[model samples]
Target: MKRNLLFSCLIIVCSSVQAIPISLEYQGFYQRLKQVNKGHYSQVELVFSVPNKEKCRIQSGNISTEKESFPLIITKEQRLFLPFDEKLKSDRALINLDIQGETKHCNIAMQVRAKQTKMEYTHGDIVEIQAEMNAMLSEMQGFPMRYFTTDIAGVSFLFEADSDVTVNIDGVVQSVSGKLRLSRAQILTLTNLKLSLKPKVISPWTNGD
Candidate 1:
């Protein structure tokens, strides 16, 4: 009985850490508006909020359409997720956003890597890097963006071929693809993802508020 109980306990612990939590929430800049179908090239924005160790401040950041966005925040007990559809992943665009209340800002030229791959995420030490891929606009620098979170277990971002925009990862180039999305416990990933040139990811005029 003792041996059996020990084995069961070990299995539980292992399983608990094996399957990392991944949740995603999809929001657009037109959340409170409406518009008509223009095209794939449209201004888009996503905000990711998480629990902060320190209080007295908001727990959210904006990822605009002016630059790449990544290095999603994931703490020890929680992970954030951002799942991108095939259409947007393949087409890249400029990503930009503000940290909110802070003077820091991100303006990156991003695009998708022409490759196909996936990854296995679990509880472990994680480092972040801003991965930038831009086939157009030669004047921009392609590199990792500033890390907004720490003590992460795993991280991922998917970019499709048709995605004609820049995408900056907060850490190393984990994976690259023309189709993908983010997954986390609370979906706190993706601070903001707005587009500089576009017909709008979510048309407020057509989609409605």
Candidate 2:
């Protein structure tokens, strides 16, 4: 029983450490919003002013759109989720939050984003992806615009190919194919990952983020 209890504790600790907490009130730039979307989940980037950790601490929150209610995830970066059908087609995104402290001025832009399907990669698209990735990384360098949450996995782009093709990042091809996830790690180690693949592997073959 003691061993079982210890194992449970370890699980909780490990989960807490791995899953980046979601923010209820923190705002992010349009370019800064990117994450690995899995089954039944598609997220939208709500442009919000950069939140200061010293001022903002989310107590609870939720969003109502198209008559569907999405509870704000205060404990995971997959904070606000919408159905795959409603992914980029939200007619409304009304958020209500209870913040621990008062925020001075959080100018949330009430604008919707243009619709985009899942990114597809082909033989010739490597250069394009690389260019966009580099541009995103460059812009993000000045403003590490995460929600001031616990951790950031960096900008993730989900790639699907017409045929099977291995994923290559920074000139290194990963074994991942068909469905791929390319992410920039937030730390010194640039962790390339195939997040959706059942046997998720963190490839340590890229430079720092």
Candidate lDDT values, in order: 0.24, 0.32
Q: Which candidate is the best by TM-score?
A: 2
**What shift in Å separates residue 196 of candidate 2 from its native position after superposition?**
27
Candidate 2's C-alpha runs over 4 A off are 1-51, 76-88, 105-132, 135-209
Looking at model 2, which ten-residue stretch has the lowest summed lDDT?
3-12
User: Tens digit of lDDT per residue, candidate 2, span 40-100?
Assistant: 1122222232233233445556665556766645443213332333442344454565544
| Per-residue C-alpha lDDT of model 1 across residues 109-196, encoded as one tens digit per residue | 1121212222322122111121111111111112122222222221233333455533333333333334333333312444433222
After superposing candidate 1, which stretches have Cα over 4 Å from the reference? Answer: 1-79, 93-98, 101-209
